[model samples]
Target chain A: MSHAIETIDLKKNYGSHAAIRGLSITVEPGTVFGLIGPNGAGKTTTLRMLLDVIRPSSGVARVLGETPQAGGPALRRRIGFVPGELRLEGRIRGRALLRHYAEISGQVAPGAVDDLADRLGVDLNREVRKLSKGNKQKLGLIQAFMHRPELLVLDEPTSGLDPLVQREFLTMVREARANGQTILLSSHVLSEIQQTADQVAVLSDGLIVAEGDVAALRLGRIRRVRASFTGIAAAALRQELDHLPTLRDIDIDVTGTEPVRLTATIDGDIDPLVKLLARHSVLDLAVEEPDLEESVLQLYGSSANGRNGEVRHG
Target chain B: MVRVLPVFRRSLGDSWRSLIGWSVGVAAALLLYLPLFPSIGGDGEMQQIIESMPPELVKTLGYEQIASGPGYTQGTFFGLIGFLLLVIAATAWGSAAIAGAEESGQLELTLAHGVSRSQYALESALAVLVKLLWLGLLAAALILALNEPSELDVTVLNVLGASKALVGLAFVSASLALLVGAATGRRSLATAAGAGIAVLGYVFNAIANQVADADWLRALSPYSWAYHEMPLSDGPDWAGLALLWGLGAVFAAAATLLLRRRDIIG
Candidate 1:
């Protein structure tokens, strides 16, 4: 079977400014593929090109074994899309808007929209304009997923969603994958993609700067830790923590004198650092899920360098 | 199977409130002007007033014929006030269908479904037609209701024909706006284009009225094509109606072509 989406050297330019420069990636038929990038990273542009919503300046894009231009409405019917900026306007109820889309999609199963709405905890009876931003975003997701399309292209699908709803959305993605739907989900949140995406391509400056297995990237990702101590000296603490096997980028400070803080970003196994930290009289300890965009850039930026799918422009 | 003309249906559905407003406004226009023809029209006072006014002003405003029923109808409504109302409505409809929707991100989401771009453009045009047709029918109905009472001696068929011509004239504006919206994806620009066509046509006609040698200008002005034959009084101008509709179709086709070639940046 052909790849679900295959773009070879595809590029897009708006005037003289290039939005997507020679992006190439192959997505398999039944997995969650994440397009990870920042706001102007060309992620949305690449997705639009695949849908033929935007024309690429150059290169080849074959979606479901057909060029997007030639595939036309037939290809679009197989793919569900949620735009990056969801704008749901109208005095009609959210359910009615969904019904309108369902009629347009035609392939939507009966009760599919209601099911998604229930899962997302959004009321369909509310007028679309009266809906909260997050609720509108949920409606956007419902319209896209209600059809159970073969390929789903979601851009920043969870941006306005609450944490609970976002978790449910990831579950929906997983369930869709289990049902054998191929997904091309794009977002700036690394943890969002890390939780659900099987393979990810980190896009930066209109190019795929890194592409790799999500599992490998996850294992290779750095964890940030902040620990406050009762009596540990800053210099002595760094000296002791530096000997640990996996910790790197260690910072020990307090802004004053008492309760010196030890903040370190570490990669690999955490057992050695945990055991060493136990030796100190720890006061306040907090382990944060690293900043989404920062952690993502670090993982895809440094480690995935010189790997497959990395593009460079002079 | 997909619903046929969902875009058309949704667009009309979305504007049902606005449609009602336009209907009421048309009814009000009929109530305001047609019933007063007895006092202002056929009394010779109105005709004398026109004769006393500058000849250029009378001709430019088409008020010279206010002494007659059909002429009063054309002067007060079809050629001026009523035409403006309908053209404004049509222009808003056309601009919103493409450029406004695209700007708000509605068009992209809709297009992401199974609907083709060409189909979207075609259906939007149909939606505009359906809307203008609704307003036209309301005007014709109200005008016919007053045809006898207001001494607007125009026949029922003639009133209907004039209304049809009015719809066609506004349709040209709507279609041109739709074409611009598709090409540029800018609502303001589309509005300007639609209004520009209506103004250009009217200016052409107005200028031709002054210059005796500018009878040829009538051929180029869409306003002339719709009104120069005096369809309200003489009879429906089949050639003029056909030209108006033909221009509408050309613009619609151009819009579809432009949309099919470019990207929907929204």
Candidate 2:
């Protein structure tokens, strides 16, 4: 498949401070690509470069097989973008704002804006200043999707959106992907991207720490497993848990309890722990993915010394 | 060829209320000041009161021709109050065209919709020009309607000429603001550039009229180019008109070039 977006060693520097450093990546056409990063990790900067709103200090970026800056308005016409910081003119009603954008793009159908507004539950008659944050976000989303462009570049698309509206947004993204449109979704929230992105790139401190298929990346990380024993003593379970090679940071709570509970984090392999559990009369067992916040923190802490080289391919 | 019509249309829609407000203000100022000219010009006592004042103050205020209908109207309204009103309107429009939009994050959104930077800047300048023209025409119509009743003795042609000079003078300040706003994307800097041009021009003209050695300063002041010959009585100064329009065009062209090269910050 041809690439939808490609950047070769893209760099942006604000005087002496480097915002994005030697970044290179390729996104396949018709795939939902997630740019996952923490705040100030240069996600918005990268998106702005692709849109030609800001020029790169070095390297190059191509959208839809053309240089962003050289392609000019024609290139921009094929891409829909939602900026992270969305500020609308307070005097304009929401409908008028969408109409203006629609007229400029010249691609949105007559009723597309109204249809999207209905789906998103946004009232188009209200002035922008009167709309709440969530409502304003809905307006932004409607404009981005109304044009039905070849590519959509969204930066923190779900910020300030309620969970229900966020779900609707994800569904819209899925529909766009199904329609053969490529999407570049940038977000600090892991789950937001994890739900819709087929491929993910994790950026930390201006460097890509890990990148691959979402499922594969999840599998590579550690998981927390908690188990409670009914017919066994806590001491007996602890002794068995020590023998398991896969378990780490193992903790046991045996304080005057009829049921013994043990919690441990495991990585690499879980078969040894499974066999140990099978030997005990386990009453309840829970295996949970690590919290996204904690996982990001751990990733940053661990990669401080040995930054993972950019994972370019899936 | 990028289409900037959508941007232009939206700008007009956004500013129509302010445009009407400015038009009403100019009309009121004209009605209030033009009718008073007959009373002041016909009364010999008022002329003597003016003659008794300091010669320097009369020269500075451009009141030498206060005894005639044309002179009285020009001194009271066109040269003083009307000039202030038009410049205020133009300055606000010019500063808001680029820098205000950028600060509000609307420029980024508009450009994302396939509008080229140069096209956006050019269209914004055109919108400001159109608004300025609207105010000028309204002022001219009101002046012409009240000409006979107020006994100002100024013809319709002369009223239009005076309006042209006012619009041309305001254009210089507006264009300066557009240039600064487009180049720097800072509203305060744009406002300062526009207000500075107007204030400095007025000060330079006033000082030139008061001091013999500084008479050459009038050549550098846009205010002089606007009102030096009293457009209503002497007809429009074609040379001054050329200079004002030429400066506006130059600043607008510079703004487009600079906007194309600079980065847009939200």
Candidate 1 residue spans exceeding 4 A from truth: A218-220, A254-256, A296-314
lDDT of 1 by residue, B1-266 (tens): 44878999899889999999988888898899999998878788888888899998888988868899999999999999889999999999999999999999998899888889999999999999999999999888888889888888888778888998999999999999999999999999999999899988998898898888987888988899999889888889999999999999999999999999989987
lDDT, residue A278, candidate 1: 91
Task: Report how far off residue B99 is in candidate 1 (Å).
Answer: 0.6
Clashes per candidate (backbone, < 3 Å)? 0, 0
| A9-70: candidate 1 lDDT, tens digit per residue | 89898999978778889999999999887788888899888888998899999999999999
Highest lDDT model number: 1
Tell me the spans in candidate 2 whose CA falls farther than 4 Å from its real position.
Answer: A219-294, A300-314, B1-4
Quality of candidate 1 docking, DockQ: 0.76
Chain B TM-score by candidate, in order shown: 0.98, 0.96
- The clash number for model 1 is 0
| lDDT by residue for model 2 (A1-314), tens | 65899999898988898888877888999999999877877899899999888899999898899988898988888888999898875678999888888777748877888889988899999998899888888898988889899999999999999899899899999999999999999998787888999998877666676788897774335779998888887787788778877678898886948688888889757777888789878889998777654565564556533354534344
DockQ of all candidate complexes: 0.76, 0.49
